[model samples]
Target: MTILICNSIIILITKTDPALQTPMYFFLRNFSFLEICYVTVTIPRMLVDLCTQKGNISFLSCAAQMCFVLMLGGVEFFLLTVMAYDCYVAIGNPLNYTIVMNQQVCVQMVAASWISVIPVVIGQTYQIFSLPFCGSNRINHFFCDIPPVLKLVCGEAFVNKIAVYIAVVFFVIIPFLLIIVSYGKIISNILKLTSARGRAKAFSTCSSHLTVVILFYGTASITYLEPKPNQYEGMGKLLSLFYTILIPTLNPIIYTLRNKDIIVALRKLLAKLLA
Candidate 1:
């Protein structure tokens, strides 16, 4: 809750600024919003559990958690896809970049990513939530995730598992493939640049995004999609912490630090204030 509140306040200020309205900041705003919704879905219950240790989450609350965690997870996956596309266009097509990534198109890209997640997450959440928990109600993790919570149920959660698999295919595989494809073309375009300076600049613009992509996917795949058993109580917990807490916070910082235009704009704004 504290994290959510503090982030909300900061994001509110950032959003009201005219200058923080580019693709990077646009990504930052959406990422911040996702953080608010994401944390709210799980933390309050976890906080209650921490205080009381009894942890009696009602069925409805459990359903809500499942829905939101998957929802936000799906949303985050799609946002990364958009961010990758943004970088690809900015580096690969500088001349038509503004026209290609105009406000309307950017808005649509963000919207399409978000819109694509709803049906997929809703279907998966519904399958998992409606099942009978005729056995242990104790969720091992701090919050209700698909695997930890699924292990507690009595009957075969095969359908739920399948739904989860479908979501994995849609959320992880498809977007990941799209990212790879986009980067391939981006590299091809970068190679075609005649000047060494041009190639270096293109690579620098893409370097931060590729770094983030590798980190996020590396942790997520290892934690959630790995074949290993449930020993991830510690490692899984850490990885979960990364995607949940770390990514959103670090994204804005990555863009500001690495992107030259953003730094120049911010510096100009700061100089005006000092003057």
Candidate 2:
């Protein structure tokens, strides 16, 4: 609920404020919407289970949940990569920033980010669910994540494991590498600015995004990339909780608190409502 409300405020403020009608805030709006969807996929069900003390989910329902999770997660990686490129262009090539990242281009990139994941997620979900589940039905984790679901498979899951690894490389690692490259260029460009104030201002624009990137990629890398041993299963769940729940909650606070534009826009909005 906190995630939803906070992110909704971002979306509302961005849409209503003319000053925020730029490429950066446009991407930020989409990201906040994505965060809302991302949390909704897992947290609500988790909450209900906690309340009822009966964490029961049907096989098809679990498959659907996992599919949405994978899709949303993939979209987030792509969106973050797009955002990194946007930052690079704004800082590295300011003259062409508006021309390059026009409204149509931004919409296309966002649409591609969303659509590109469908086939990959569907194929992966189908492959995982097609396997026989003759073993214990209980999922060790809070959600129907790939790792925990794979554990319940009856037969050898070598192929499934390979597919998952490939997906992670293509969707997660590759995007992260692209973000790193974009930021590298951005940093180089920022340093070239002769004026200290110019450099500081440039850094300020990126600080919020950089913080979000670290919070997201840091927790995600630890959760997904690391070897999942039985001894670390408990640790794994805790890490999953961080990425899935904590990150979404923090994102709105990070952006709104760090961004002066958002702060001013929010204040104006509040004053207008009160008046």
Candidate 3:
């Protein structure tokens, strides 16, 4: 998976001349880098547990894994929201897109997304880690997911529950609502275009982004937003797979497959390679 994702990023980064430094491409690279980070942060540890003779992790390692998974998950979701806004601006007002989304603003937005997610991650991780896990040593899922892992703890998990709820509202629900609002405005603007052709062109630009948002939010809403009982262990693991493993793989494909410019760029690069 790592090799595959690395090759994909290399192809994307080198598809055009090195000087093809537009904001859109820059955002693509950022997303690509995040995807790579997202996978690396969890997958190796997961595969190790599955493949190793004895799947054992120390308490600290488990805590670290949970924290990073939270950070990456939150960061990726917020980045998606930021990308939606970027698309909204690009399509809603093409002439002023560059000026409005200048380098400083872009950098600051990306940085803020990462920064904002850190506290949520820390809060949630602390909530889970502070509990006493005296029951189960093995995690049901391949990864150290909080909800399932917290069940192993033989303590009052009320603090963790409250913190997780607060973090969910702040990190996931609120940003998801913003994505919906932004897309609504974008759709409105696209519909107001003078002709069918213009509206189609504008809508095409955001469809890929919308697809990602749905997949992320739909799976996540099921996994985190819904209540989980101890008996529903299988469902918890399944939801974990959806957000962590599945989404990372699909995110790159969604961006590259539906993006017309990326397709054109890849074809040009391939032709040059063959020549």
List where candidate 3 sits over 4 angstroms from the true fold.
Answer: 2-11, 14-20
| TM-score for each of the candidates | 0.84, 0.98, 0.92
Top TM-score model:
2
Candidates by lDDT, descending order: 2, 3, 1
The full ranking of all candidates by TM-score, starting with the best, is 2, 3, 1
As for TM-score, the candidate ahead, 2 or 3, is 2
lDDT per model, in order?
0.75, 0.92, 0.78
Q: lDDT for model 2, on a 0 to 1 scale?
A: 0.92
Considering lDDT, which of the candidate structures 2 and 3 is the better prediction for this target? 2
Candidate 2 Cα outliers beyond 4 Å, as residue runs: none
> Which ten residues in a row are the worst by lDDT in model 3?
2-11
> Model 1: clashing residue pairs?
none
* Residue ranges of candidate 1 with Cα displaced over 4 Å: 1-21, 44-48, 51-54, 228-233, 264-275
Q: Which residue pairs show backbone clashes in model 2?
A: none
Which residue pairs clash in candidate 3?
Answer: none
